[model samples]
Target: MVKGKLHSIETFGSVDGPGIRTVFFMQGCPARCLYCHNPDSWKMSDGRETDIDELLHRAKRGMPYYGNNGGVTFSGGEPMLQGEFLIEAMKRFKEVGINTAIDTSGTYYDKNTRGVIEQADLLLLDIKHTDSEKFTELTACKQDPLFKVIEDIKEFNKPIWIRQVIVPGINDSKEYIESLNEFIKDFKTVENIELLGYHKMAIDKYKKLGMEYKLDGVPEMGKEVMEELRALVRFPGKEMKKAC
Candidate 1:
C-alpha cells in the first residue's frame, strides 16, 4: 500500500481548483518559492503519513456535493512528490466516478510522475514566472521539469489551467507577459489562464515558523493588474468559465 505524507485537507476549498473541491495538501516540495504560503508543507517530516484507503474514505463523504460539481483536488507543497500515492488515490476516485485535479508547481517530473498525472482530469499548473532566470531566483528550482510537465499534459490530452502569481516586481513586466503568452502557445491542453494576485497573509506563517519573509516590503497585487495579465495570455482550449 502506498502512503502519502499529507500536510492537511480542505473540505470545501473554492480557490484551489474547479467547483467546491476537497483539497488534499500533500507534503514535500523541491522548490522553495519565496512567496510560498504553505511553508509548513515544504518539509517532508512535518505531515502525517497515511494511505489511499483512508483518503478514499474521507473523499467518499463528499459524494452528494461531488454530484453538484465538486470533487477531489490534490494540492501541495508539491503533490508530485507523492506520485505513487496520488496514482493510487486517483485510481480509487476514478472507480467511483469522482473528478480529480492537481495543483502543482511542477518542480518534480519523472517517468513515474508522468504516469500518475495521466489519470488526472484537470491540472492546475503554476507558472511562477515566464522568464527562466526569474523563475530560478523565485523558486530555487530548474525550469526543465516545469516545461516537461506542460508537455506531458499536452501529450496526455488532459485539461490544464495555467496559474501565474503576479508578484510585484518579480514577474509583472510587460515583456514577461508577452514571453508567457508565447511560451504557452505550444500547449493545446491549457483550457484557461488564471492570474493570482500576491498577498501578505502568509508573512505571519513565515514568522511563526522562524523562516525569513522574503517579500516583506512587497505590496499586494491589484485586480487591474490581474485583468491585464489575463488579457495578455488568452490560453487555447475549451474554457471552463467557472470562477474558482
Candidate 2:
C-alpha cells in the first residue's frame, strides 16, 4: 500500500482550491520560506503516516459538499515530496469523478513529480519571489525547479492559478510582478494570478514549535497594497478576483 507522511487534513477548506474542498496537508518541504506558517510540516518525520485508501474514505464522506465545483486538494509541506503517494491518491480520486487540485511551491520538480502533477485538474503554483537571488535568500531553495515545473505544466496543458505571497520587502515589488508577467506571458495555461496578502498569523505557530519567527515585526499587507500588486500582474480584468 502506498502511504505518505501527513501533517493533517482540513475537511472543509475554502482557500486552497475551487469551491468547498478537502485539503490534505502532506508532510515535508524542501523550501525554507521565512514566513512559512506551518513550520511544523517542514520536517519529514514530524507527522503521522497514512495510506491512500484511508484518505479516499475520508474524501467520500464529503462527497455531498464536493458536488460539481469542489473536490480534493493536495497541499503541503509540498505535496510533491511524497509523489508516489500523491499520484496514487490522485488516480483514486479521478476514478470516483472527483475534481483534483494541488497547491505546491514547485520547489521539487523532476520526472516523477511532473508525472503526478500531469494528472491534476488544477494547480495552485506558488511563486515565492521573482528575483532568483532574493528568492534563494528568502527560501534557501532554487527557483530553477519551479520554472521547470511551469514549463512542464505548459506542455501538459493543465489549468494553473499562479499564487504569490506578497511579503512587504521580499517579493511585493513592481519590478518582480512585471518580470513575472513577462515570464508567464508565453504560457497560455495560466488562468489566474492570486496575490496573497502577507500576514503574521503563523507567528504563534512558530513560537509554539520553538522556531524563530523572522517576520514577527512585519505587518500584514493591506488591501490597497494588495490591489496595487494585483494590477501589476496584468491578468485580464474579468479574472481578477480576491481569494479569501
Candidate 3:
C-alpha cells in the first residue's frame, strides 16, 4: 500500500477550493517561492505517513460540511510530489462521491503524476512567472513544467483555477500581465484566474528555521494593484470575463 507523507490537515478550509473543504497539506516541494508561508513544508522526511484508507476515514468525517460543493483538496509543499499516494487517494475519493482537488506548484511532470492530474476534479495551479527568464530567477530552477502541465490539463478539459502571486517588482509590470494573458488564453479549460496579492506572511517561519527570507523589504501587494492587473489580463476564455 502506498502511503502519503502529510505535513498537516485542516478540517474546515474555505479558500483552498469550493464550499468547505477538508485540506490535506502533503509534505515536500520542488520549487522554493520567495513568499512561501509554510517554509517548514519543504522537507519530505519531516512529515508523518498514512495510507489511503486511514486518510479517507479522517476526510470522510468532514463530509457533513462538504455537502455538494465542498470535498477534499490535496495541497502542499506541492501535492504532485506524492503522485502515487494522490492517485490512490483520488480513486477512493471518487468511489465515495467526494470531489477531489489538487493545489500544486506546477513543477512535477512525469508518468506517475499524470494519473494524479486526471483523477482530480479541480486544480489550483500556481503560476510563478509568465516569462521563462523571470521564472528561472524566481523559482531558482528553469524547468517549464507549468507549460507542459497547462497543455496536459487542457487535454483533460477539466476545470482549473490559475493562481498568480503578484510580487512587487517581479511580476507586476504591464508587460508581464499581457504575457500572462497570452499564455493562459490558449487553455480551453480554465474556469477562473486568481490574482493573489503577495504578502510576507512567512517571514517569521523563516526566522524560526534560521533561513534567510528572500523578499525581506518587499511590501505586501495591494488589492488596487491586483485589480489593475485583473483588468489588464482580462482572462480570455468564456467571454473573457473577470476572474474570481
Candidate 4:
C-alpha cells in the first residue's frame, strides 16, 4: 500500500476550510517561506509514514463534528509533494462521502499532482507574492510552477480560496492588496480571498528546531489593520468575504 509522510494531524481545525475539519499536515515542501510556523515539516524523512486506510480511519473519528461542511483538508509542507499518495487518499475519502480539500502553497505540480488537483473538492491556495522577484525572496522558489498549476485549476474549474499572509512591513499595503484583487479578478471560481495576519508565533518553533527564524523581529499583523487591507480586495462575488 502507498503511504504518506505525515507531519501532524488536527482533529477539529476551524480555519483551514469550510467547517470543522480533520487537517492532515503532509510532510516535505520545496518552498522555504520565511515566516512558516511548521518548519519541522519541511523534511519528508522527519514525518511518520501513514497509509491511506489508517488516515481515513483516524479522520472518521471527527465525522460527527464535521456536520455538512466539515471534512478533511490535506495541508503542508505542501501536500502536493506527495501527489500520487494524495490522489489515492482523496479518492478513498470521497468514496465514503467525506469532503476533501487541499491547502497548498501552489509551489509544485505535475501529472500526478494534477490528479490530486482534479480530485480535490476545494482548494486553499496561497499566492505568496504576485511579483516574481518578491515571490522568490519570500519562498526561495520560482513562481512559475504555481502559475502553471493555476492554469490547470482554471481548466478543471475547481473552487478555490485564495490566501496571502499579510506581513506587516512586507506585503501590508493598500497598493499590494489592490493589485491582488486585480490578479484574481478573472478567477471566477474563487470562492473567497483570505488575507491572513502574519504573526511571530513561529519564533519558538524555530528556536526549538534550532532553525533561524527569518521574520524574527516582525510584529504580528493587527486585526484592525488587517480589516483595513481586507477592504481593498474587490473580487466580484467574494469582496471582503472571510473563509467560512
Candidate number with greatest lDDT = 4
Backbone clashes per model, in order?
A: 0, 0, 0, 0
lDDT of 2: 0.85
**Model 2 alpha-carbon miss at residue 240, Å:** 13
**Where does the lowest 10-residue lDDT sum fall in candidate 3?**
234-243
lDDT by residue (tens digit), candidate 3, 58-156: 889999889888999999988988988899899998999989999988777777667888899999888888777778778875657777777778888
Deviating ranges (above 4 Å) for candidate 1: 237-244
Alpha carbon lDDT at 209, candidate 3: 95
TM-score of 3: 0.94
Q: Candidate 3: misplaced stretches above 4 Å?
A: 238-244
List the candidates' TM-scores in order: 0.93, 0.93, 0.94, 0.95
Shift in Å, residue 148, candidate 3: 2.1
Worst 10 residues of 4 by lDDT: 235-244
| Candidate 4 or 3, higher lDDT | 4
- State each model's CA lDDT, in order: 0.85, 0.85, 0.85, 0.89
Between 3 and 4, whose TM-score is larger? 4
lDDT of 4 by residue, 45-157 (tens): 99998999999998889989999989999998999999999999998998988999999897887678788889999989999998889999999999988887788788899
lDDT of 2 by residue, 1-244 (tens): 8878999999988998888899999999999999898999999989899998899998988889987779999998999888888888999999998889999897887657888878899999898877788789888898898888887788899888888888887767778777777666776777778889998899888878888988878888889988987876865333434657
For model 2, the run of ten residues with the poorest summed lDDT:
234-243
Worst 10 residues of 1 by lDDT: 234-243
After superposition, the stretches of candidate 2 with alpha carbons farther than 4 Å from their true spots are 236-244
